[model samples]
Target: MKLGRHSPAPKRQKCDHWSPCPPGNFAYRILSGGGKERTATICFEDEQLVGEPGSGINIAIVNYKTGEFSSTNFFHMWAHDHSKQMMDFIRSAPKGTLLLMATQDDGSTRLKDYAKELVENLGSKEIKNIKFRSSWVFIAAKGFNLPDNIQREKINHSDQTKNRYKGWPAEIQIEGCIPRNLM
Candidate 1:
């Protein structure tokens, strides 16, 4: 009986999640790169912390307790020897920090084994399998452990026979609600 423009349809959860997270949880979304148009993206608690197009690795650090981002940075792994620096950055994150990573283009050409090993310590099972132009995304907690049921990582490799783009693979994405009480 009362309405000019209907109250905008019930707002969707952050990052367009299909459903709202429970009261004590936060939502997040991670999208990997795919060609020139599809770049990488990272969303935490309904806020986009990183979404730039380039060729390398994108990283975001979040304070688990505060629910705020502490830093956002990327490395050019395709054309530069930034693996050492990337490793150093990862090592610096303290306990209770949430680390999110996504690939924009080629993330393994310049990535050394040391860097991959470091990521593995954080529970990434696919870091070693990444190949040229592979789309990858990962989330890990520095000190605490994420629930085993949560989706922690994903990857898509560029296959000449079935790539979505002429020279790039299709993008991959992962979204989930993380419990805020994670210690």
Candidate 2:
């Protein structure tokens, strides 16, 4: 475990008290107890621009033990056409699993374009809109960190109301950039 911290090589795939890797690294992990947050990283490692420098990876943890969802964000442009592997990794999670994904709104066609890739590549039968906060978007499995009633309210609306959602996240916008605070 200590070696991970001292390795100075690159990223860690798993987490332990000695060596803790963040949520986005494929080797990221949690403590021995199930109560700790658990995460799995999804990477798009290609020559494509999305996988290039200045890009980052962030995963929202679904600490089911606590029934809470704390989100994170990474702003990067995805120039690829599709990512079937990423979609499969997301869908592979158990229904109650609180797996989440988010990215900053870069104010470009590429953002929506990558979103479209998700909608098309997803293998799940159920359909749900991604959550939008200031300048961010969230995609998660059904029943992911939401109570049944609130989740229903969100689902009923085609687009987010102009008003803010819980004073933080708002419904996602299909065009234009997200507000400055959101970014």
CA RMSD for every model? 3.0, 16.1
Q: Which parts of model 1 are misplaced by more than 4 Å? A: 1-10
- Candidate 1: residue 127 Cα off by (Å): 0.4
For every model shown, the clashing-pair count is: 0, 3
- The models' CA-based lDDT, in order, is 0.90, 0.30
For candidate 2, the clash count comes to: 3
User: How much does candidate 1 score in TM-score?
Assistant: 0.92
TM-score list, all predictions = 0.92, 0.31
The TM-score measured for candidate 2 stands at 0.31
10 residues in a row with least lDDT, candidate 1: 158-167
lDDT of 2 by residue, 1-183 (tens): 355445466553222223442333222111110001212122211111111122212334443433344332333335542234444444555455444333332212233444445543432112234323223223334433332221111111223343333323232211111111110
lDDT of 1 by residue, 61-131 (tens): 99999899999889888778899999988988889999999999889998999899999999999999999
Instruction: Write down the RMSD of candidate 1 (Cα, Å).
Output: 3.0
